[model samples]
Target chain A: SQKIEQNSEALNIQEGKTATLTCNYTNYSPAYLQWYRQDPGRGPVFLLLIRENEKEKRKERLKVTFDTTLKQSLFHITASQPADSATYLCAYNAGNMFTFGGGTRLMVKP
Target chain B: NAGVTQTPKFRVLKTGQSMTLLCAQDMNHEYMYWYRQDPGMGLRLIHYSVGEGTTAKGEVPDGYNVSRLKKQNFLLGLESAAPSQTSVYFCASRSQGTGELFFGEGSRLTVL
Candidate 1:
């Protein structure tokens, strides 16, 4: 069975610093990978999507890199602010089946 | 536009009680899904519908049943609730050829 793993521990970073979160998968590669931002008590909002053929993708201060060789994807937030605090989830779509990781909570402290 | 809407934002059920969760999407999407989220467990797909009157089981479909009588509506039912069923339920939909999913506010269920 395919499995997605994200750091369950909360990540604390100083405001203005770069925050990086990781998502790793096992079993097989996916057609695409996605990152979503989830605030407390709210549904997740799509942030970025990177295809298996694309090495990197960027939107504003956010960037996502997919390393199919490593079966990993890294999500980065540059010049992070306190408002950027939230849980980040990583998901992959294979044959139209989407699988999500447990997500990593991020806290940007001032 | 209300991309996706889920009824009964929250519910509390006793063991063995039965209830249903409703999901509606106005996007006219071809795909809709039901998922459950538990602490540190991520989101597990329970069931999904690809079109009106068509349904399929997902990763965690056990103990749950679904219906897609209408293209805009998907229903999830629990005939006999259990404590292990307690989790936040989310309904999402995506259009054909798109991988992005639009999610609802979520429905929190607690089985005591």
Candidate 2:
């Protein structure tokens, strides 16, 4: 079965450091991958989208890297702040549909 | 600009009741989608439309129906709501062939 996996556990990191999250998938080849940030009791807000051909993408302090060879993607938030704390979801295209993995919650200490 | 909006920002329904959630977008997007978000489940596509009047099933389409009669509006209807269907529903849209998605604030639904 093709499955999308992300860190089910919460991550706690220092405010000034970069926080890295991982997303892994099996048995599927997606054309593109996306990262979204969702706060409690709210819909996800789009962060970045990286095509399979692209190795990495960045927006301000957020960076997303896609590695089709390894069937994985990494999302990094540099200079993490308490305001940057949120659940990050990684999604991939699946036959015209988008599949999202269970998000990784990051809590940056103030 | 109201990029995307969902009617009935919040609702509480009894099991077996029926309701429709309306999503409207001003972005003139060609594709629209509906999804449900639950704890430990992230977001699951319930239904989507590639364009006006063209609806399609998604990963978890069961127990949900959709309509896109107009270019800028999509509706999600629940024939019979259930406790298991209680979730925060989101509406999103993007341009044709573009992988980017813009999302609405969301509709919080509770079933008793």
The number of the candidate with the highest TM-score is 1
In model 2, what is the error at residue A6, expressed in angstroms? 0.7
Candidate 1 per-residue lDDT over residues A1-110, each given as its tens digit: 88899999999999999999999999788888999999999888889999999999999999999999999999999999999999999998756568899999999999
TM-score of 1: 0.97
Tens-place lDDT digits, model 1, residues B2-105: 89999999999999999999999999998999999999799999998889999998999999999999999999999999999999999999767567888999
**What TM-score against the true fold does each predicted structure earn?**
0.97, 0.95
Fnat of each prediction? 0.68, 0.81
- Each candidate's iRMS in angstroms? 0.7, 1.1
Writing each residue's lDDT as its tens digit, candidate 2 over B1-112 gives 9899999999999999999999999989988999998877888899999889999998898899999999899999999999999999999997565677888999999999
Clashes of each: 0, 0
Candidate 1 off by > 4 Å = none
Candidate 1 all-Cα RMSD: 1.0
